[model samples]
Target: MMGPTHALSAGVAFLAVATPMSHYVHHLTPATAAVGTVVAAGAGILPDFDHRQATPARAFGPLSAALAWTIGKLAGGHRHGTHSIIGTGVFVALAAAATLNPWALAATLWLCMGLAVRALWKHPPNRPNGKLDYRDVAGLIHAAIAAYIAYQLVHSGLDMGVVPWAVAVGYLVHLIGDSMTEMGVNWLWPHPRRYRIASIDTGKTVEKRVVVPALYVGLAATVYLTYPKWGPVLLHTLQPTTG
Candidate 1:
């Protein structure tokens, strides 16, 4: 699946789980829920960081490119170690650890938000005259904004409890997305066998027509179903406070 599709699927998955979980998990405030959703969307492309050519790798220019190179080597190339069940656990653990410290959490959020913007935002295509692409500049602007938001969240003392589960679900959704592709993923790495439940070509007709639409519908349905709970909170957040 494409980066945008992976991200959309992960965001949808987070809401799907969070909607029901909210009923039982009383601490899931609107702020935390919003953060979790964004985090999940970002983490959806986390596995793709193992590929230098992936969207997340191109997100932050040389810095992300260098990280991707190191990760690709450590992960034994794309769709190998990072696409496995083991990789999910590792990422979740890292997220949990990041939540333990405000600075670390802020950094994590910044990275995730940057990744989310790069995947979700539709920047202009490259110029036909071989001029500079506004896409790269747009990414930098988004990165700056993401940094500010991350800092604000950390400063607000927002609950960090939801980070781990968001990361886990988002990462798993990514793996699941790839598993449905024609190439499939190595669910259990080092086993030398790829597993897939369906074969949909990435960015092709099946994904474009079926899977993408289903994800959008699912996102809308889950939002509608849970509006009764989070809707007021969102409205309240948006409302101006009396001095």
Candidate 2:
């Protein structure tokens, strides 16, 4: 699956289960649900840190590029160690540990937001003769959004304990998405055996035309179901006022 598709899938998955699971999971709150949704969307693209040219790699100019390069090398190339079940557990552990320190958690949230925005937000079309590519403009906008969300998340009084679960679910969702593609992921990495159920081509007709669109629909439906009051709020905001 491609970056946007992966993001949408994870976001949908998170929202779909967040409400029902909230009953058993004491840390969940409205604020946490909203924040976790975004974080999960970003985490969906985290495994692709093994690909130097992937969206997360280029999201933050040279800093992220360097980080991606380093992770890619350490993970032994794309879809290897980082795409495995062990990799997912490692990410969850790291996320859990990061929550112990406020600064580390803030940085992690910021990076996740940046990755999600890079994948999910629509960029302007490139100009044929312009000196500045609009894609750069979009990048600046995404960075601003990421920074704002990160700041809000750091300050929001919501419980931070559920974040590691969000990270874990998002990472697993990404692996599952890849498992549906023709190039399946190795669930147990070092063993070299891959598990697959479907053969959808990444970014091709099935993905671009079918899978992504369906995921978008699923996201919308899940969001509606998760946030029932949002519909009334949206309607109230959109309703015209008369003196």
Candidate 3:
């Protein structure tokens, strides 16, 4: 239910120094700072794995597809498993596990990428099995590139320690955003019943026009308030200068 924009905004909000999460991540060095942001923001898109057309699924391709298939099959597909506490637990567990061994994680990603490429090239998308659609090719490439970027970041001296927490925080933020939608999440595990705000709808005028703009504002505000580049200046302006 949470759109990519809102989820990313929530991630940014969580990353902001003003947020509770800042205590753990505020000490990050310049190089790893953006990496932290990327981890969090990327994680924000995790819940949407059920929707093949969703950006998270598109960006992650076969990796997302596999996860979606597995969880969906377990919870009756799209919008059910991924929206429940049990499903969320599965996501967070996978995220935490990946950070424990970056090399193995990278290898898994490579395998997924290879499969995606094969699906796009060797096999036709229309097999009637709905495994790999022709439209998924571009997304697979993008997902592969994202996977490579993470691999390089791991190899290039970035701390993997920050990853699991960032991913968890981002995933939770996505859930919160989705809770605001009319079709809310099942939040409780093993229970299919959903809960929502009862007023908001996904992709409606309110979401596109109001919610999206609000997300932009929230992102901008978070950056202005917490970004190292701008935070110091804002604080400096707020404090009375010592003559």
Candidate 4:
């Protein structure tokens, strides 16, 4: 799926779950909801940064690849290392330390970790080119991480409002959207080994078709869910707001 598509799906998923959650918790102010939603969306994209070696990253410049390579090297190269549970935990720890928000950090970390484990366990050594399917593994790891983050945001006590629910929804949508593509996600990765769904490859025509519409629809949903009248008005009035 395209970057926009992925982002939209994740964003939409976050909003969907976050919104309802906000209502349920009733403790999360509008600002908290917004922050949580944004964090969830960001987490969704965190894993794909591994594509720096591919053409997608080339558009930016060699620096993009270099950065990705450096990060990959640190984590465990392509898929086996940083893209794993251990790596996700490290990232969560770092995020927590940096932000000083244990709940948010933990949530994001959990999202990525879950997905990575699932992906790693599901697609067992079916490399097409005899080389490690680094890209595949990386994608799955990231997806799992993204899903976990979304889940955390929705359930976190920060907000029991609609925003949290929206975040969760958007994240799930993102995962499912990715699954629809030829690069199917190992939704049941660890348990259901060698499982895959029939779909278009990433960056393919069919994949684009599915992704584009999904993006627009998700964005629309986010708008509706975040609307002041329909959703929560957290963005505007929260004490000790984040900059």
Best by lDDT: 1
In Å, residue 155's CA in model 4 sits off its true spot by 25
Ranking by lDDT: 1, 2, 3, 4
lDDT winner between 1 and 4, please give it: 1
Candidate 4 yields a Cα-based lDDT of 0.48
Candidate 4 residue-wise lDDT, 7-105, digit = tens: 555655665655566566544565565565555554454545555443223222333345566776664443333333444455545554533455654
State the lDDT of candidate 1 residue by residue for 1-243, as single tens digits: 788899989998898788666677636887788888989999999999998878887776556767889989989999998999888888888889998888888888888877887887646431232234665566566667888988998888777788887888899999998888888899888786999989867565766788778888888888898888889988998899999
RMSD in angstroms, candidate 1? 2.9
lDDT of 2 by residue, 1-243 (tens): 678898989988888878666778645766677778888999999999998767787676556667888999988899999999999988899999989988778878988878888787645432233244555556566667777777677777668877788898789999998998888999998889988979777556777888889998998777767567445655675689978
Off by over 4 Å in 1: 23-26, 124-138, 241-243
User: What does candidate 3's lDDT look like per residue over 1-243, in tens digits?
Assistant: 434464556456545643454454444544444555555665666666666555444444566666656655777766677777777687667766876787755643343333223322332332233566655675566566756865776687655555556556666777777787767788885687887755455566666677667776777777766666545655675688688
Clashes of 4: 48
Compute each candidate's TM-score over C-alphas.
0.88, 0.84, 0.72, 0.51
The candidate with the higher TM-score, 3 or 4, is: 3
The number of residue pairs in model 2 that clash at the backbone is 0
